[model samples]
Target: MNKHIADTKNNDVIRPTQAEAEAAVKTLLLWLGEDTSREGLIETPKRVAKAYKELFSGYQQSPEEELGTVFEEVAGYKDMVLIKDISFFSHCEHHMVPIIGKAHVGYLPNGSVVGLSKIARVVDMFAHRLQTQESMTAQIAHSIQNILKPLGVAVLIEAEHMCMAMRGIRKQGSTTLTTTFTDAFETDIANQVRFMTMLRSGS
Candidate 1:
């Protein structure tokens, strides 16, 4: 990318505030052939704008900060910190439809560990975005690995993409599973096997 273009992209990458969000919603309403000024629709744009802010608030958050608060209390436990079945909802950018699913996350801490809830928050952050499950999986795993610098990191996402089910071919049974792994989870069989088995059993 060109220097100026890269800078522009970085600056524009931040979350849009109410006014911008409202404008986008208004545009959508117009495209749908509705008068946003009508009684019921009058505040609909504003509501949508506010909802988008909350839904995509991940852009305003710092994954590093969320994971930075660590605990030294786990002591000698060498096992992976597994948090399974975290329910999440997001929009697919391709069709801007809801993608709902559960995320199974695990990490092997090396002397330090973060709050268990923060892992879920990290998952929510990226999931709130309009994303492909593949990027969502890798982003969560990479974020955890980068912040915790754990012995290993694994993330799996299983989701129903509404873009496919509600439109296009409209296949009801379609679901996507995406995963990402690092360190021993990536190169070591026993570690990967254990993690996968644990995830399968929903432990």
Candidate 2:
């Protein structure tokens, strides 16, 4: 099992109850000049609260726990293991708007390998929270490195931020790309080229 990081600051804080959260949502609707008492809008606050719970559920999960089960029965298989095109939806921490994207993750296994679905779960776990693309990319890479202790790890994220497309200097169809490489993937040119080639070939 992987060692879990202790989040003392967050754990020590008390969060508001569901009713209080729903009330806050109502406040937002009122601030937006929407009448919350209307039949159509009356239940919106509760619905929004429930939706938020699902959107930010990453706070309640442990990535280490998700990647805890590892299989070491590989019959001398040792090479880059890549999982690409993992679609995810996250909210920008600054604007609270959607950051939609896909991630490509690869790692060179040292000895053991984790279940493939767990890799996607790790990506989803981080995506279910308020995040910056850069931080989220690093978080995914670091968590996998910490848990699997692989020879190398690479994470690439290409995303469209609603903060840019829906507000501010709106540039529709613009996308952001971020990458993080560790160990061999960072130092070896051949490994980098191979990873890039593999990604492009699939597209």
Candidate 3:
């Protein structure tokens, strides 16, 4: 593994260039005891580089930019904004395999609201990257909170990480749940309960 991956931390995520990615692929191909120069596999490095570019495309985008455009008129609505069972697929930073799951997001509007589809878009935007579920939850909540500036924001992700199930402990049935809450959602029980009840009601 490249040592550079260990010391780099840019917060949003690191996106390596095409040559860098191809070099990593070549390194792996050689370590696998395969002739990377064979005609059949000659272009594997380039294809894998392209695939990674697509897989981790989330790093290239800003969640704030995605959520920047919002609506001020919400029909004078005042209630918990809940979007549940929003499906997501992400690559684990460790193993780079898929973490397939659903996310439940809730927020209390502070006189402004975002498009419903934008919520799912935000989830997808963050998920299509190399991440820990912990960071994924935090990024989603923080991004929404930063962009919409909602009164409160809460996010929960229930997922199955292939890194754990298909490797490590090999426990297939176990699921990881990660939650992140901000402001009223963090300090107020009533607000937290409201979000939890909505999550339960949907389930």
For every model in order, what is the number of clashing pairs? 0, 0, 0
* Per-prediction TM-score: 0.89, 0.93, 0.86
Per-residue lDDT of 7-95 in model 2, one digit per residue for the tens?
A: 54387756777787788999999999998999999999899999998999998888889999988988878999999999999999999
Q: Per-residue lDDT for 1-203 in model 1, tens only? A: 11222223247554455576677888989999998888999899888877876887776677887787988888688788899999999888888899999999989999988888999999988887788888889999998998888999988899999888999998987889888989989999898888889988865
Off by over 4 Å in 1: 1-17
Which is the leading candidate under lDDT?
2
Candidate number that wins on TM-score, 1 or 3: 1
Error of 3 at 29 (Å): 1.1
Question: Residues 88-168, candidate 3, lDDT per residue (tens digit)?
Answer: 899999888889999999999999888889999889989987899999999999989888888899999999999888888
Off by over 4 Å in 2: 1-9
- Cα RMSDs of all predictions? 4.3, 5.3, 4.1
Clashes of 1: 0
lDDT for each candidate structure? 0.85, 0.92, 0.87
lDDT of 3 at 19: 77
Would you list the rank order by TM-score, best first? Answer: 2, 1, 3
Q: Comparing candidate 2 with candidate 3, which one achieves the higher lDDT?
A: 2
